[model samples]
Target: MNGPALSIQTLDKVYANGLKALDQVTLEVRRGEIFALLGPNGAGKTTLIGAVCGIVQPSGGRIEVFGHDNIREYRKARSHIGLVPQELTTGMFETVWNTVSFSRGLFGKPANPLYIEQLLKNLALWEKKDTQLRMLSGGMKRRVLIAKALSHEPDLLFLDEPTAGVDVELRKSMWAQVRRLREMGVTVILTTHYIEEAEEMADRIGVINKGRLIVTEDKKTLMHKLGRKELLLDLYKPLEALPPSLAGLGLRIAEGGMRLVFTYDPAQENNGVVSLLDRLREEGVKCKDFNTRESSLEDIFVQLVGDS
Candidate 1:
Protein backbone atom coordinates (compact mmCIF):
# COMPACT_ATOMS: atom_id res chain seq x y z
CA MET A 1 0.00 0.00 0.00
CA ASN A 2 3.00 2.28 0.39
CA GLY A 3 3.78 2.02 -3.32
CA PRO A 4 1.87 3.63 -6.15
CA ALA A 5 -1.08 1.70 -7.52
CA LEU A 6 0.24 2.10 -11.08
CA SER A 7 3.55 3.44 -12.47
CA ILE A 8 4.90 3.96 -15.98
CA GLN A 9 8.46 4.97 -16.84
CA THR A 10 9.48 6.11 -20.33
CA LEU A 11 6.62 4.18 -21.93
CA ASP A 12 6.36 4.26 -25.73
CA LYS A 13 3.84 2.73 -28.16
CA VAL A 14 3.99 2.78 -31.94
CA TYR A 15 1.45 1.38 -34.37
CA ALA A 16 2.03 -0.47 -37.63
CA ASN A 17 0.98 2.50 -39.77
CA GLY A 18 3.78 4.63 -38.31
CA LEU A 19 1.50 6.32 -35.80
CA LYS A 20 3.21 7.15 -32.55
CA ALA A 21 0.33 6.57 -30.17
CA LEU A 22 2.36 7.07 -27.02
CA ASP A 23 5.76 8.76 -26.64
CA GLN A 24 8.02 8.39 -23.66
CA VAL A 25 5.07 8.67 -21.28
CA THR A 26 5.79 8.56 -17.55
CA LEU A 27 3.24 8.75 -14.76
CA GLU A 28 2.14 7.30 -11.42
CA VAL A 29 -1.27 6.81 -9.94
CA ARG A 30 -1.26 7.05 -6.15
CA ARG A 31 -3.03 4.37 -4.17
CA GLY A 32 -6.78 5.04 -3.78
CA GLU A 33 -6.68 8.34 -5.63
CA ILE A 34 -9.01 9.36 -8.48
CA PHE A 35 -6.65 10.66 -11.15
CA ALA A 36 -8.24 12.18 -14.26
CA LEU A 37 -6.36 12.13 -17.57
CA LEU A 38 -7.48 14.94 -19.88
CA GLY A 39 -6.77 14.82 -23.59
CA PRO A 40 -8.33 15.30 -27.00
CA ASN A 41 -9.34 12.53 -29.38
CA GLY A 42 -6.34 10.61 -30.76
CA ALA A 43 -4.21 12.16 -28.01
CA GLY A 44 -3.15 8.66 -26.82
CA LYS A 45 -5.32 8.62 -23.69
CA THR A 46 -6.94 5.35 -24.72
CA THR A 47 -3.63 4.00 -26.02
CA LEU A 48 -2.00 4.68 -22.67
CA ILE A 49 -4.81 2.90 -20.86
CA GLY A 50 -4.61 -0.01 -23.30
CA ALA A 51 -0.89 -0.43 -22.70
CA VAL A 52 -1.26 -0.72 -18.93
CA CYS A 53 -4.21 -3.10 -19.28
CA GLY A 54 -2.15 -5.26 -21.68
CA ILE A 55 -4.44 -4.87 -24.70
CA VAL A 56 -1.67 -2.90 -26.43
CA GLN A 57 2.01 -3.69 -25.86
CA PRO A 58 4.47 -0.84 -25.46
CA SER A 59 7.40 -0.64 -27.82
CA GLY A 60 9.77 0.43 -25.01
CA GLY A 61 9.98 1.21 -21.27
CA ARG A 62 8.25 -0.26 -18.22
CA ILE A 63 4.83 -0.43 -16.59
CA GLU A 64 4.21 -1.65 -13.07
CA VAL A 65 0.93 -2.23 -11.33
CA PHE A 66 0.87 -2.84 -7.61
CA GLY A 67 4.65 -3.46 -7.62
CA HIS A 68 4.48 -6.13 -10.36
CA ASP A 69 6.02 -5.53 -13.79
CA ASN A 70 3.15 -5.61 -16.29
CA ILE A 71 5.06 -7.58 -18.93
CA ARG A 72 7.31 -9.87 -16.85
CA GLU A 73 4.69 -10.57 -14.20
CA TYR A 74 1.69 -10.17 -16.46
CA ARG A 75 -0.65 -12.40 -14.51
CA LYS A 76 0.16 -10.98 -11.11
CA ALA A 77 0.06 -7.39 -12.34
CA ARG A 78 -3.11 -7.81 -14.45
CA SER A 79 -5.00 -9.49 -11.64
CA HIS A 80 -4.90 -6.25 -9.67
CA ILE A 81 -6.15 -4.05 -12.53
CA GLY A 82 -9.65 -3.87 -14.05
CA LEU A 83 -10.50 -1.83 -17.14
CA VAL A 84 -13.87 -0.34 -18.14
CA PRO A 85 -13.41 0.32 -21.82
CA GLN A 86 -15.07 2.98 -23.97
CA GLU A 87 -16.63 0.33 -26.15
CA LEU A 88 -18.97 -2.39 -24.84
CA THR A 89 -17.77 -5.81 -26.00
CA THR A 90 -20.13 -8.13 -24.15
CA GLY A 91 -22.49 -10.25 -26.20
CA MET A 92 -26.04 -8.97 -26.50
CA PHE A 93 -27.39 -12.35 -25.36
CA GLU A 94 -25.42 -12.43 -22.10
CA THR A 95 -27.26 -11.65 -18.89
CA VAL A 96 -25.80 -9.01 -16.61
CA TRP A 97 -25.05 -11.41 -13.78
CA ASN A 98 -23.54 -14.01 -16.09
CA THR A 99 -21.44 -11.46 -17.91
CA VAL A 100 -19.98 -10.06 -14.73
CA SER A 101 -19.46 -13.56 -13.32
CA PHE A 102 -17.75 -14.63 -16.54
CA SER A 103 -15.32 -11.74 -16.21
CA ARG A 104 -14.31 -12.95 -12.77
CA GLY A 105 -13.85 -16.47 -14.04
CA LEU A 106 -11.70 -15.22 -16.92
CA PHE A 107 -9.34 -13.86 -14.29
CA GLY A 108 -9.17 -17.36 -12.73
CA LYS A 109 -11.24 -16.34 -9.71
CA PRO A 110 -13.61 -18.85 -8.17
CA ALA A 111 -17.26 -17.91 -8.17
CA ASN A 112 -18.16 -15.86 -5.11
CA PRO A 113 -21.91 -15.31 -5.32
CA LEU A 114 -22.06 -13.23 -2.15
CA TYR A 115 -19.39 -10.84 -3.36
CA ILE A 116 -21.01 -10.63 -6.79
CA GLU A 117 -24.37 -9.97 -5.25
CA GLN A 118 -23.02 -7.15 -3.12
CA LEU A 119 -21.22 -5.71 -6.13
CA LEU A 120 -24.34 -5.72 -8.29
CA LYS A 121 -26.37 -4.15 -5.51
CA ASN A 122 -23.75 -1.46 -4.96
CA LEU A 123 -23.77 -0.57 -8.66
CA ALA A 124 -27.60 -0.59 -8.76
CA LEU A 125 -27.54 -3.47 -11.25
CA TRP A 126 -29.07 -6.12 -9.01
CA GLU A 127 -32.58 -5.67 -10.39
CA LYS A 128 -31.30 -6.00 -13.92
CA LYS A 129 -29.05 -8.97 -13.27
CA ASP A 130 -31.26 -11.31 -15.23
CA THR A 131 -31.72 -8.98 -18.19
CA GLN A 132 -29.74 -9.26 -21.41
CA LEU A 133 -27.20 -6.57 -22.22
CA ARG A 134 -29.10 -5.44 -25.34
CA MET A 135 -32.29 -4.87 -23.38
CA LEU A 136 -30.70 -2.39 -21.02
CA SER A 137 -30.57 1.40 -21.48
CA GLY A 138 -27.25 3.07 -22.31
CA GLY A 139 -26.79 4.22 -18.74
CA MET A 140 -27.62 0.76 -17.41
CA LYS A 141 -25.17 -0.77 -19.87
CA ARG A 142 -22.47 1.53 -18.50
CA ARG A 143 -23.34 0.41 -14.99
CA VAL A 144 -22.94 -3.19 -16.13
CA LEU A 145 -19.52 -2.28 -17.54
CA ILE A 146 -18.43 -0.93 -14.17
CA ALA A 147 -19.82 -4.03 -12.43
CA LYS A 148 -17.84 -6.23 -14.80
CA ALA A 149 -14.64 -4.29 -14.11
CA LEU A 150 -15.02 -4.79 -10.37
CA SER A 151 -16.12 -8.41 -10.69
CA HIS A 152 -12.66 -9.71 -9.85
CA GLU A 153 -12.17 -7.15 -7.06
CA PRO A 154 -9.23 -5.32 -8.62
CA ASP A 155 -7.20 -2.90 -6.51
CA LEU A 156 -6.83 -0.49 -9.43
CA LEU A 157 -9.57 0.35 -11.98
CA PHE A 158 -9.42 2.21 -15.27
CA LEU A 159 -12.59 3.94 -16.45
CA ASP A 160 -12.40 5.18 -20.03
CA GLU A 161 -15.09 7.84 -20.35
CA PRO A 162 -17.39 6.25 -17.79
CA THR A 163 -20.22 8.69 -18.45
CA ALA A 164 -19.56 9.70 -22.04
CA GLY A 165 -23.16 9.88 -23.19
CA VAL A 166 -24.95 9.84 -19.85
CA ASP A 167 -27.65 12.35 -19.04
CA VAL A 168 -26.95 15.08 -16.50
CA GLU A 169 -28.61 13.16 -13.66
CA LEU A 170 -26.85 9.94 -14.60
CA ARG A 171 -23.51 11.75 -14.84
CA LYS A 172 -23.97 13.03 -11.29
CA SER A 173 -24.88 9.54 -10.14
CA MET A 174 -21.69 8.18 -11.70
CA TRP A 175 -19.66 10.88 -9.93
CA ALA A 176 -21.07 9.70 -6.58
CA GLN A 177 -20.43 6.10 -7.59
CA VAL A 178 -16.77 6.91 -8.34
CA ARG A 179 -16.43 8.58 -4.93
CA ARG A 180 -17.74 5.40 -3.31
CA LEU A 181 -15.12 3.39 -5.20
CA ARG A 182 -12.38 5.59 -3.72
CA GLU A 183 -13.86 4.99 -0.27
CA MET A 184 -13.54 1.25 -0.89
CA GLY A 185 -9.77 1.85 -1.47
CA VAL A 186 -9.95 1.25 -5.22
CA THR A 187 -7.57 3.48 -7.14
CA VAL A 188 -9.32 4.92 -10.24
CA ILE A 189 -7.87 6.39 -13.43
CA LEU A 190 -10.38 7.90 -15.81
CA THR A 191 -10.31 9.75 -19.12
CA THR A 192 -13.29 11.90 -20.02
CA HIS A 193 -14.56 14.40 -22.63
CA TYR A 194 -16.18 16.38 -19.89
CA ILE A 195 -13.59 18.53 -18.13
CA GLU A 196 -16.10 19.60 -15.45
CA GLU A 197 -16.58 15.97 -14.46
CA ALA A 198 -12.82 15.75 -13.96
CA GLU A 199 -12.95 19.00 -12.02
CA GLU A 200 -15.71 17.67 -9.80
CA MET A 201 -14.18 14.24 -9.13
CA ALA A 202 -10.42 14.18 -9.61
CA ASP A 203 -7.86 14.35 -6.76
CA ARG A 204 -5.16 15.13 -9.32
CA ILE A 205 -5.22 15.98 -13.03
CA GLY A 206 -2.86 15.22 -15.91
CA VAL A 207 -3.18 17.00 -19.21
CA ILE A 208 -1.99 14.95 -22.18
CA ASN A 209 -1.62 16.48 -25.63
CA LYS A 210 0.03 15.32 -28.85
CA GLY A 211 0.86 11.96 -27.29
CA ARG A 212 2.74 13.63 -24.47
CA LEU A 213 1.86 14.62 -20.94
CA ILE A 214 2.05 18.40 -20.68
CA VAL A 215 1.17 18.90 -17.05
CA THR A 216 0.24 16.88 -13.99
CA GLU A 217 -0.59 18.44 -10.64
CA ASP A 218 -2.88 18.43 -7.64
CA LYS A 219 -6.27 19.89 -8.67
CA LYS A 220 -6.33 22.92 -6.39
CA THR A 221 -2.66 23.68 -6.84
CA LEU A 222 -2.96 23.51 -10.60
CA MET A 223 -5.94 25.82 -10.51
CA HIS A 224 -4.16 28.31 -8.28
CA LYS A 225 -1.09 28.29 -10.47
CA LEU A 226 -2.86 28.84 -13.79
CA GLY A 227 -6.35 29.98 -12.93
CA ARG A 228 -7.20 33.64 -13.54
CA LYS A 229 -9.70 35.73 -11.60
CA GLU A 230 -12.20 37.94 -13.37
CA LEU A 231 -13.75 40.78 -11.46
CA LEU A 232 -16.97 41.83 -13.24
CA LEU A 233 -18.37 45.22 -12.41
CA ASP A 234 -21.90 46.22 -13.40
CA LEU A 235 -21.84 49.89 -14.14
CA TYR A 236 -24.45 52.43 -13.06
CA LYS A 237 -24.25 53.90 -16.58
CA PRO A 238 -22.77 52.92 -19.90
CA LEU A 239 -19.27 54.26 -20.54
CA GLU A 240 -18.18 55.43 -23.97
CA ALA A 241 -14.55 54.28 -23.64
CA LEU A 242 -11.83 53.30 -21.21
CA PRO A 243 -9.36 55.82 -19.75
CA PRO A 244 -5.61 55.50 -20.55
CA SER A 245 -4.58 54.67 -16.97
CA LEU A 246 -7.15 51.80 -16.83
CA ALA A 247 -5.90 50.29 -20.10
CA GLY A 248 -3.01 48.25 -18.70
CA LEU A 249 -4.97 46.65 -15.85
CA GLY A 250 -6.37 43.99 -18.21
CA LEU A 251 -9.70 45.74 -18.38
CA ARG A 252 -12.21 44.86 -21.04
CA ILE A 253 -15.49 46.62 -21.75
CA ALA A 254 -18.23 44.07 -22.03
CA GLU A 255 -22.02 43.68 -21.86
CA GLY A 256 -22.52 46.34 -24.51
CA GLY A 257 -20.12 48.66 -22.67
CA MET A 258 -22.23 48.58 -19.49
CA ARG A 259 -19.92 46.25 -17.57
CA LEU A 260 -16.21 46.37 -16.85
CA VAL A 261 -14.27 43.11 -16.65
CA PHE A 262 -10.93 43.09 -14.88
CA THR A 263 -8.89 39.97 -15.50
CA TYR A 264 -5.87 39.30 -13.27
CA ASP A 265 -3.75 36.54 -11.87
CA PRO A 266 -4.87 36.10 -8.26
CA ALA A 267 -1.61 34.42 -7.21
CA GLN A 268 0.62 37.39 -7.94
CA GLU A 269 2.17 39.37 -5.07
CA ASN A 270 0.20 42.46 -6.10
CA ASN A 271 -2.76 41.59 -8.37
CA GLY A 272 -3.70 45.18 -9.21
CA VAL A 273 -7.33 44.73 -8.18
CA VAL A 274 -6.91 47.52 -5.61
CA SER A 275 -5.42 49.77 -8.26
CA LEU A 276 -8.29 49.02 -10.61
CA LEU A 277 -10.77 49.90 -7.87
CA ASP A 278 -8.95 53.15 -7.26
CA ARG A 279 -9.00 53.93 -10.97
CA LEU A 280 -12.74 53.22 -11.08
CA ARG A 281 -13.26 55.66 -8.22
CA GLU A 282 -11.14 58.33 -9.94
CA GLU A 283 -13.02 57.92 -13.20
CA GLY A 284 -16.32 58.07 -11.31
CA VAL A 285 -17.36 54.78 -12.86
CA LYS A 286 -19.86 53.91 -10.18
CA CYS A 287 -20.55 50.21 -10.13
CA LYS A 288 -23.96 48.92 -9.18
CA ASP A 289 -22.64 45.41 -8.51
CA PHE A 290 -19.37 43.51 -8.64
CA ASN A 291 -18.49 39.83 -8.50
CA THR A 292 -15.28 37.85 -8.83
CA ARG A 293 -14.97 34.49 -10.55
CA GLU A 294 -11.97 32.21 -10.55
CA SER A 295 -11.07 30.29 -13.71
CA SER A 296 -12.48 26.75 -13.83
CA LEU A 297 -10.66 23.54 -14.64
CA GLU A 298 -12.35 23.73 -18.03
CA ASP A 299 -10.77 27.12 -18.59
CA ILE A 300 -7.28 25.87 -17.85
CA PHE A 301 -7.92 22.74 -19.88
CA VAL A 302 -8.91 24.76 -22.95
CA GLN A 303 -5.92 27.01 -22.51
CA LEU A 304 -3.55 24.08 -22.29
CA VAL A 305 -5.07 22.07 -25.10
CA GLY A 306 -4.94 25.19 -27.32
CA ASP A 307 -7.55 24.72 -30.10
CA SER A 308 -7.96 21.03 -29.54
Candidate 2:
Protein backbone atom coordinates (compact mmCIF):
# COMPACT_ATOMS: atom_id res chain seq x y z
CA MET A 1 0.00 0.00 0.00
CA ASN A 2 2.94 2.34 0.55
CA GLY A 3 4.41 1.79 -2.93
CA PRO A 4 2.99 2.03 -6.42
CA ALA A 5 -0.05 -0.20 -6.85
CA LEU A 6 0.58 -0.83 -10.56
CA SER A 7 3.50 -0.20 -12.90
CA ILE A 8 4.16 -0.75 -16.62
CA GLN A 9 7.55 -0.65 -18.27
CA THR A 10 7.88 -0.59 -22.08
CA LEU A 11 4.74 -2.69 -22.45
CA ASP A 12 4.09 -3.72 -26.04
CA LYS A 13 1.56 -5.98 -27.71
CA VAL A 14 1.33 -7.38 -31.22
CA TYR A 15 -1.28 -9.75 -32.54
CA ALA A 16 -0.72 -12.70 -34.87
CA ASN A 17 -2.01 -10.56 -37.73
CA GLY A 18 1.00 -8.26 -37.29
CA LEU A 19 -1.08 -5.45 -35.87
CA LYS A 20 0.45 -3.60 -32.94
CA ALA A 21 -1.99 -3.01 -30.14
CA LEU A 22 0.40 -1.25 -27.79
CA ASP A 23 3.73 0.43 -28.48
CA GLN A 24 6.25 0.92 -25.72
CA VAL A 25 3.48 1.96 -23.30
CA THR A 26 4.68 2.87 -19.83
CA LEU A 27 2.66 4.20 -16.90
CA GLU A 28 2.02 3.83 -13.16
CA VAL A 29 -0.96 4.05 -10.84
CA ARG A 30 -0.23 5.40 -7.39
CA ARG A 31 -1.92 4.10 -4.27
CA GLY A 32 -5.33 5.69 -3.54
CA GLU A 33 -5.45 7.84 -6.71
CA ILE A 34 -7.93 7.65 -9.54
CA PHE A 35 -6.15 7.38 -12.89
CA ALA A 36 -8.22 7.89 -16.04
CA LEU A 37 -7.30 6.54 -19.47
CA LEU A 38 -8.72 8.59 -22.36
CA GLY A 39 -8.72 7.71 -26.03
CA PRO A 40 -10.84 7.24 -29.12
CA ASN A 41 -12.00 3.87 -30.42
CA GLY A 42 -9.28 1.36 -31.46
CA ALA A 43 -6.73 3.31 -29.40
CA GLY A 44 -5.63 0.16 -27.47
CA LYS A 45 -7.33 1.04 -24.17
CA THR A 46 -8.90 -2.39 -23.88
CA THR A 47 -5.75 -4.12 -25.07
CA LEU A 48 -3.68 -2.40 -22.41
CA ILE A 49 -6.15 -3.40 -19.71
CA GLY A 50 -6.25 -6.97 -21.00
CA ALA A 51 -2.50 -7.33 -20.77
CA VAL A 52 -2.37 -6.12 -17.21
CA CYS A 53 -5.21 -8.41 -16.12
CA GLY A 54 -3.58 -11.53 -17.64
CA ILE A 55 -6.28 -11.96 -20.28
CA VAL A 56 -4.25 -11.02 -23.33
CA GLN A 57 -0.56 -11.87 -23.55
CA PRO A 58 1.84 -9.06 -24.36
CA SER A 59 4.31 -9.54 -27.16
CA GLY A 60 6.95 -7.60 -25.21
CA GLY A 61 7.69 -5.63 -22.02
CA ARG A 62 6.71 -6.02 -18.39
CA ILE A 63 3.83 -5.20 -16.02
CA GLU A 64 3.88 -5.38 -12.26
CA VAL A 65 1.02 -5.38 -9.78
CA PHE A 66 2.19 -4.37 -6.31
CA GLY A 67 5.76 -5.60 -6.97
CA HIS A 68 4.69 -8.92 -8.55
CA ASP A 69 5.49 -9.37 -12.24
CA ASN A 70 2.33 -10.12 -14.16
CA ILE A 71 3.91 -12.86 -16.31
CA ARG A 72 6.35 -14.55 -13.95
CA GLU A 73 4.09 -14.37 -10.89
CA TYR A 74 0.74 -14.61 -12.63
CA ARG A 75 -1.31 -15.76 -9.64
CA LYS A 76 0.25 -13.38 -7.15
CA ALA A 77 -0.03 -10.42 -9.54
CA ARG A 78 -3.55 -11.26 -10.71
CA SER A 79 -4.72 -11.92 -7.17
CA HIS A 80 -4.06 -8.30 -6.34
CA ILE A 81 -5.89 -6.97 -9.41
CA GLY A 82 -9.63 -6.83 -10.13
CA LEU A 83 -11.00 -5.93 -13.54
CA VAL A 84 -14.64 -5.02 -14.23
CA PRO A 85 -14.91 -5.37 -17.97
CA GLN A 86 -17.01 -3.19 -20.26
CA GLU A 87 -19.28 -6.09 -21.12
CA LEU A 88 -21.74 -7.76 -18.73
CA THR A 89 -21.17 -11.52 -19.03
CA THR A 90 -22.31 -13.03 -15.75
CA GLY A 91 -23.98 -16.48 -15.61
CA MET A 92 -27.72 -16.02 -16.10
CA PHE A 93 -28.81 -18.88 -13.80
CA GLU A 94 -26.40 -18.04 -10.99
CA THR A 95 -27.58 -16.15 -7.95
CA VAL A 96 -25.85 -12.83 -7.19
CA TRP A 97 -24.44 -14.10 -3.92
CA ASN A 98 -23.22 -17.36 -5.45
CA THR A 99 -21.43 -15.65 -8.33
CA VAL A 100 -19.72 -13.06 -6.15
CA SER A 101 -18.64 -15.62 -3.60
CA PHE A 102 -17.35 -17.91 -6.37
CA SER A 103 -15.14 -15.13 -7.74
CA ARG A 104 -13.37 -14.80 -4.41
CA GLY A 105 -12.83 -18.57 -4.30
CA LEU A 106 -11.31 -18.44 -7.78
CA PHE A 107 -8.48 -16.36 -6.33
CA GLY A 108 -7.95 -19.11 -3.74
CA LYS A 109 -9.39 -17.01 -0.93
CA PRO A 110 -11.46 -18.74 1.75
CA ALA A 111 -15.21 -18.06 1.77
CA ASN A 112 -15.90 -15.04 3.93
CA PRO A 113 -19.60 -14.42 3.86
CA LEU A 114 -19.18 -11.25 5.88
CA TYR A 115 -16.88 -9.65 3.33
CA ILE A 116 -19.15 -10.58 0.45
CA GLU A 117 -22.17 -9.28 2.34
CA GLN A 118 -20.46 -5.98 3.02
CA LEU A 119 -19.45 -5.60 -0.64
CA LEU A 120 -23.01 -6.32 -1.76
CA LYS A 121 -24.39 -3.78 0.67
CA ASN A 122 -21.88 -1.16 -0.39
CA LEU A 123 -22.93 -1.60 -4.01
CA ALA A 124 -26.62 -1.64 -3.07
CA LEU A 125 -26.89 -5.22 -4.26
CA TRP A 126 -27.54 -6.87 -0.93
CA GLU A 127 -31.30 -6.76 -1.41
CA LYS A 128 -30.97 -8.76 -4.63
CA LYS A 129 -28.37 -11.22 -3.36
CA ASP A 130 -30.72 -14.21 -3.62
CA THR A 131 -32.06 -13.25 -7.07
CA GLN A 132 -30.71 -14.90 -10.18
CA LEU A 133 -28.60 -12.86 -12.58
CA ARG A 134 -31.28 -13.06 -15.30
CA MET A 135 -33.86 -11.54 -12.93
CA LEU A 136 -31.74 -8.42 -12.39
CA SER A 137 -32.06 -5.29 -14.48
CA GLY A 138 -29.21 -4.09 -16.68
CA GLY A 139 -28.04 -1.51 -14.13
CA MET A 140 -28.35 -3.96 -11.28
CA LYS A 141 -26.35 -6.54 -13.20
CA ARG A 142 -23.63 -3.95 -13.73
CA ARG A 143 -23.57 -3.41 -9.99
CA VAL A 144 -23.18 -7.13 -9.48
CA LEU A 145 -20.08 -7.05 -11.65
CA ILE A 146 -18.67 -4.37 -9.40
CA ALA A 147 -19.44 -6.44 -6.31
CA LYS A 148 -17.70 -9.47 -7.78
CA ALA A 149 -14.64 -7.40 -8.62
CA LEU A 150 -14.40 -6.14 -5.06
CA SER A 151 -15.16 -9.51 -3.44
CA HIS A 152 -11.51 -10.25 -2.81
CA GLU A 153 -10.63 -6.71 -1.73
CA PRO A 154 -8.09 -6.15 -4.49
CA ASP A 155 -5.44 -3.50 -4.06
CA LEU A 156 -5.90 -2.27 -7.65
CA LEU A 157 -9.25 -2.06 -9.48
CA PHE A 158 -9.77 -1.47 -13.20
CA LEU A 159 -13.12 -0.08 -14.28
CA ASP A 160 -13.66 -0.22 -18.01
CA GLU A 161 -16.50 2.14 -18.91
CA PRO A 162 -18.18 1.59 -15.53
CA THR A 163 -20.95 4.13 -16.17
CA ALA A 164 -21.74 3.22 -19.75
CA GLY A 165 -25.51 2.98 -20.31
CA VAL A 166 -26.20 3.60 -16.62
CA ASP A 167 -28.79 6.19 -15.57
CA VAL A 168 -27.74 9.60 -14.25
CA GLU A 169 -28.67 8.82 -10.65
CA LEU A 170 -26.94 5.43 -10.66
CA ARG A 171 -23.83 6.90 -12.31
CA LYS A 172 -23.63 9.57 -9.63
CA SER A 173 -24.02 6.99 -6.90
CA MET A 174 -21.35 4.79 -8.45
CA TRP A 175 -18.88 7.67 -8.62
CA ALA A 176 -19.50 8.41 -4.95
CA GLN A 177 -18.79 4.77 -4.14
CA VAL A 178 -15.60 4.84 -6.19
CA ARG A 179 -14.45 7.92 -4.30
CA ARG A 180 -15.03 6.04 -1.07
CA LEU A 181 -12.95 3.13 -2.35
CA ARG A 182 -10.08 5.53 -3.08
CA GLU A 183 -10.38 6.87 0.45
CA MET A 184 -9.89 3.28 1.67
CA GLY A 185 -6.48 3.26 -0.06
CA VAL A 186 -7.37 1.24 -3.18
CA THR A 187 -5.94 2.32 -6.52
CA VAL A 188 -8.57 2.94 -9.18
CA ILE A 189 -7.79 3.00 -12.90
CA LEU A 190 -10.67 3.60 -15.29
CA THR A 191 -11.05 3.91 -19.06
CA THR A 192 -13.90 6.16 -20.14
CA HIS A 193 -15.17 8.21 -23.06
CA TYR A 194 -17.17 10.47 -20.77
CA ILE A 195 -14.97 13.53 -20.41
CA GLU A 196 -16.91 14.83 -17.44
CA GLU A 197 -16.32 11.59 -15.57
CA ALA A 198 -12.56 11.97 -15.90
CA GLU A 199 -12.78 15.68 -15.14
CA GLU A 200 -14.72 14.94 -11.98
CA MET A 201 -13.03 11.79 -10.62
CA ALA A 202 -9.50 11.51 -11.95
CA ASP A 203 -6.38 12.73 -10.14
CA ARG A 204 -4.33 12.17 -13.32
CA ILE A 205 -5.09 11.63 -17.02
CA GLY A 206 -3.32 9.57 -19.70
CA VAL A 207 -4.14 10.03 -23.37
CA ILE A 208 -3.54 7.20 -25.86
CA ASN A 209 -3.62 7.50 -29.61
CA LYS A 210 -2.88 4.94 -32.34
CA GLY A 211 -1.64 2.39 -29.79
CA ARG A 212 0.81 4.72 -28.10
CA LEU A 213 0.58 6.84 -24.98
CA ILE A 214 0.67 10.49 -25.98
CA VAL A 215 1.15 11.86 -22.50
CA THR A 216 0.34 11.30 -18.84
CA GLU A 217 0.25 14.11 -16.31
CA ASP A 218 -1.71 15.38 -13.33
CA LYS A 219 -5.23 16.39 -14.37
CA LYS A 220 -4.67 20.08 -13.62
CA THR A 221 -1.32 20.11 -15.38
CA LEU A 222 -2.73 18.39 -18.46
CA MET A 223 -5.58 20.86 -18.64
CA HIS A 224 -3.34 23.85 -18.18
CA LYS A 225 -0.87 22.54 -20.74
CA LEU A 226 -3.32 21.86 -23.56
CA GLY A 227 -6.64 23.57 -22.85
CA ARG A 228 -7.60 26.75 -24.70
CA LYS A 229 -10.28 29.38 -24.03
CA GLU A 230 -12.56 30.59 -26.78
CA LEU A 231 -14.61 33.76 -27.13
CA LEU A 232 -17.86 33.40 -29.05
CA LEU A 233 -19.26 36.50 -30.74
CA ASP A 234 -22.92 36.50 -31.71
CA LEU A 235 -23.17 38.78 -34.69
CA TYR A 236 -26.14 41.07 -34.98
CA LYS A 237 -25.98 40.93 -38.76
CA PRO A 238 -24.25 38.67 -41.25
CA LEU A 239 -21.38 40.17 -43.20
CA GLU A 240 -20.23 39.00 -46.62
CA ALA A 241 -16.66 40.20 -45.97
CA LEU A 242 -14.37 41.44 -43.24
CA PRO A 243 -13.04 45.01 -43.03
CA PRO A 244 -9.35 45.64 -43.94
CA SER A 245 -8.29 46.88 -40.46
CA LEU A 246 -9.42 43.65 -38.72
CA ALA A 247 -7.23 41.51 -41.00
CA GLY A 248 -4.54 40.91 -38.35
CA LEU A 249 -6.97 39.42 -35.81
CA GLY A 250 -7.66 35.69 -35.97
CA LEU A 251 -11.41 35.33 -36.01
CA ARG A 252 -13.44 32.47 -37.39
CA ILE A 253 -17.08 32.58 -38.45
CA ALA A 254 -19.19 29.74 -37.10
CA GLU A 255 -22.83 28.64 -36.65
CA GLY A 256 -23.73 29.27 -40.28
CA GLY A 257 -22.50 32.89 -40.18
CA MET A 258 -24.43 33.69 -37.03
CA ARG A 259 -21.34 33.65 -34.78
CA LEU A 260 -17.66 34.46 -34.81
CA VAL A 261 -15.17 32.45 -32.70
CA PHE A 262 -11.75 33.42 -31.40
CA THR A 263 -9.32 31.11 -29.57
CA TYR A 264 -6.55 32.19 -27.18
CA ASP A 265 -4.58 31.21 -24.12
CA PRO A 266 -5.49 33.16 -20.98
CA ALA A 267 -2.06 32.58 -19.41
CA GLN A 268 -0.19 34.34 -22.22
CA GLU A 269 1.22 37.85 -21.90
CA ASN A 270 -1.56 39.28 -24.09
CA ASN A 271 -4.73 37.42 -25.05
CA GLY A 272 -5.30 40.06 -27.78
CA VAL A 273 -9.06 39.57 -27.45
CA VAL A 274 -9.59 43.09 -26.05
CA SER A 275 -7.48 44.52 -28.86
CA LEU A 276 -9.34 42.38 -31.39
CA LEU A 277 -12.68 43.75 -30.15
CA ASP A 278 -11.31 47.30 -30.25
CA ARG A 279 -10.14 46.76 -33.81
CA LEU A 280 -13.54 45.32 -34.76
CA ARG A 281 -15.19 48.48 -33.41
CA GLU A 282 -12.68 50.68 -35.22
CA GLU A 283 -13.57 48.88 -38.48
CA GLY A 284 -17.30 49.49 -37.99
CA VAL A 285 -18.06 45.82 -37.17
CA LYS A 286 -20.80 45.25 -34.64
CA CYS A 287 -21.99 42.34 -32.55
CA LYS A 288 -25.10 41.79 -30.54
CA ASP A 289 -23.57 39.73 -27.66
CA PHE A 290 -20.64 37.49 -26.75
CA ASN A 291 -19.83 34.62 -24.42
CA THR A 292 -16.77 32.58 -23.43
CA ARG A 293 -16.30 28.84 -23.63
CA GLU A 294 -13.64 26.98 -21.68
CA SER A 295 -11.93 24.02 -23.26
CA SER A 296 -13.17 20.67 -21.91
CA LEU A 297 -11.52 17.27 -21.70
CA GLU A 298 -13.17 16.34 -24.97
CA ASP A 299 -11.70 19.38 -26.66
CA ILE A 300 -8.20 18.54 -25.43
CA PHE A 301 -8.60 14.90 -26.48
CA VAL A 302 -9.67 15.92 -29.94
CA GLN A 303 -6.77 18.32 -30.30
CA LEU A 304 -4.18 15.83 -29.07
CA VAL A 305 -5.42 12.85 -31.09
CA GLY A 306 -5.91 14.98 -34.16
CA ASP A 307 -2.33 16.20 -33.92
CA SER A 308 -0.99 12.67 -33.45
What's each prediction's clash count? 0, 0
Give residue 186's lDDT in candidate 1 (0 to 100). Answer: 97
Give candidate 2 misplaced runs (Cα > 4 Å). Answer: 231-263, 266-296
The digit string of per-residue lDDT tens for model 2 on 5-71 reads 8899999999899999899999988988999998877889999999999999999999999999999
- lDDT by candidate, in order shown: 0.90, 0.87
**What's the TM for model 1?**
0.82
The superposed Cα distance between candidate 2 and the true structure at residue 285, in angstroms, equals 15
| Candidate 1 clash figure, as a count | 0
Model 2 per-residue lDDT at 18:
95
- Write candidate 1's Cα lDDT for 1-308 as tens digits: 59999999999999998899888899999998999998878889999999999999899989999999999999999999999999878889999999999999999999999999999999889999999999998888888999999999998999998888778998998999999999989999999868787789999998888788888899888777777889999999998789887887779999988999988888897999898898899988899999999877677777888843
TM-score, one value per model: 0.82, 0.81
Candidate 2, poorest ten consecutive residues by summed lDDT: 239-248
The true-structure Cα RMSD of candidate 2 reads: 4.7
Q: How displaced is residue 220 in candidate 1, in Å?
A: 1.3
Question: Can you give the lDDT of residue 69 in candidate 2?
Answer: 95
